[model samples]
Target: MSQPHLSSEATDPASAALPLRRVLPAFAVDVALAATLSFSTLMLGLFGWAVWRGIQLAQQHGGAPDAHALQAQIGTPPVLFLIVTTLVSTGGTALLLYVWRRRATAAERRESTRRLGKPSTWGWALAAGGVTFLFSSLMSAGGRALGLDLQPSNLDLIREGFARFPVFLTLFAVVLAPLYEELLFRRVLFGRLWRAGWPVLGLVLSSVVFALVHELPGLNGKPADSTLFLILVYAGMGAIFAWVYRRTGTLWAPIAAHILNNAIALAVLQIYGDAPA
Candidate 1:
């Protein structure tokens, strides 16, 4: 009896090269759908809050509220929108992977899970805290040398939000973040790139894209100095995360590391209320 030949679809090259034309379109469609749903949800939530507050103010004072106060309240929508977008994008990506690609077999995923040795959770958490502190300090020094302002304004926001919603903040920072980020950045994008036979280029490209997605240009149609500094920092962090994932061949390690880093930042911000200059 002759051995059977493997099917073309089962071949590595054919499996990997799933045509950018088809892949890109599907990816774009999913992202657009996610954005639309997230934006709608954000708008409804913001509108409801605004209406509630307006009614409360009217009941108390029997007149319209101060213009500045109203504006400040309205200003919160954009930030909320960003948070919603992050959640929806991450969730949508995971759904897409499950429904479409079926990228890794069950066995492969199980093996990947097993590869992530059971390191002490607290040790990882402490190590991640040290890493974040050292990296942030180094980045801040570089920014200062370059005449750039790299303030910890985002850290302040995280601290304030955590104080207000401690349990929710913990869930978001520790669980949702690591799971979604690892799935999107490591399993989906990086895995695809690596299989395409350009591991190094793929790593850098994905990291750059990750950083760029977080950036927002200035109101006057110019990029902010702080934004540039943040992009560099985020990109470097992405590369580090990618390395961790690749080395372990398991998403758990990177996810744990990321959660630890964010949790540490939250702790520091709460304790120190932003690092001193």
Candidate 2:
């Protein structure tokens, strides 16, 4: 009896319709959590820098320095900032996802577990990664053909930051990032809406949001046409990840694919970038 109702709830036409009220809370929570994590990581970086600067100023000036003086001494400790934020965001998000999974319904848990246990999931991820890389390259070429500059600002940042701290940045960009991002964007943001019968909405909304989050920092002073093209490139990548997640029924699928994609990008950056010749 219970199994039948469960099956029907998953398959029923009525359930296929939007369940906004039921899903909205979860969706809101997901967004809130991701935002909070980002904000907290940023604040932590600022706080660390402030504390370090304050102590330095006190030692040199023989007293607690004023805000004006501290402001004058302000300099970004990029390596420290990156390391701290990476740990906070990645660890915090992993814990959050764990708790969310634990609270999920039995059917959902079973479905996830089953998907995770499948060997074919890795194969799907590898193929998805290859296809996504090809798709992104074509998109970039298309944008260039239209005379739009489509360079990814985030990749530039990663390349610069990686030069400062090669090993940790490599680990973060190659491993931790894929795990953290796919879980946040695909599993939380996209999955909640998808399970609530808004699959298309899930894909578009999550992809756009993901792209904006990544690209907004670099968009200032850019031409509108180029900005739109850049956003579309990233949004397309996010859509691929979401699609793979939906098809493979496992976050690991997208996570693995994301890892592969990032690895390839990092490899390209190293090969063609300004390495000491």
Candidate 3:
């Protein structure tokens, strides 16, 4: 039978090593998609401000805006920017997913099916989330030990944005974001690299890229040192998610952990943030 040849091909070390050019999105599409999402986010920020300003103008009968409205709108920019980007990125992520699914190799499909059938695959996601949470906490502590203060950049801005628009921002963070991010970082990019015979390399690369994209810049809570440590913290979480994805061979594991992590963060922020006197 032909089974022997198939077994040898699977076992042969040389067969696992493919040409570097084979990893298209792994080397190219991932970066392109990231850049596209960033550009769209920036453009949406400007567009949202323009649209809001027009609405304010109409409400104010062409006079100067009320002080309260102006104050509230202070946080509108970032919130609107993310909300719009969520919508735009959702479509982009979906398209990428479709393309990858259609083009996936038979081996990859079989592996995915096998992983999906395992009961323990998804159960590991909860443990992964807990581990990542500990990792994030450790990174934060380490940053503090190094005298860096190390709060997220624009932490207050994000909080205020949530205060101004809680529902949409919450949905974006806890739901839309995890889905979109998992699709790009774990599903399309990691899966592509996995199928391309660079699973370990893919794990590290996707995690680093994920962290880089989310490292909020330009406004730290304290200014003791650079953002290198913060990047490590974010990267740690990304690595955990990537590990979950790898173990399960399905996007659901990492996606669930991501949502849990974000949901916990959002809840903590809402619950423990500054209280009124």
**Which candidate wins on TM-score?**
2
Per residue, candidate 2 scores C-alpha lDDT tens digits across 186-209 of: 766787677678978889988988
lDDT of 3: 0.64
lDDT of 3 by residue, 38-99 (tens): 56766765677767875776577676567676555544455666556655755465455446
The reply for model 3, stretches above 4 Å from the true place, is 1-14, 21-26, 51-81, 90-114, 165-167, 216-225, 274-277
TM-score-superior candidate, 1 or 2: 2
What C-alpha root-mean-square deviation, in Å, does candidate 3 show against the real structure?
A: 7.5
Task: Give me the runs in candidate 2 sitting further than 4 Å from their true place.
Answer: 1-14, 64-69, 90-94, 97-106, 116-119, 145-147, 217-221, 274-277
Q: lDDT winner between 2 and 3, please give it.
A: 2
Q: Where does candidate 1 stray beyond 4 Å?
A: 1-103, 118-133, 145-147, 219-223, 275-277
Q: Pick the candidate with the highest lDDT.
A: 2
Give the alpha carbon lDDT tens digit for every residue of 60-154 in model 1.
76787697876565445444444555566555555555345535655555565456444643354346546755786688777878877666445
Q: What is the lDDT of residue 29 in candidate 2?
A: 72
* Model 1 whole-model lDDT (C-alpha atoms): 0.59
The candidate 2 region of ten consecutive residues with least summed lDDT is 1-10
Residue 178, candidate 2: C-alpha displacement in angstroms: 0.7
- The better-scoring model by lDDT among 1 and 2 is 2
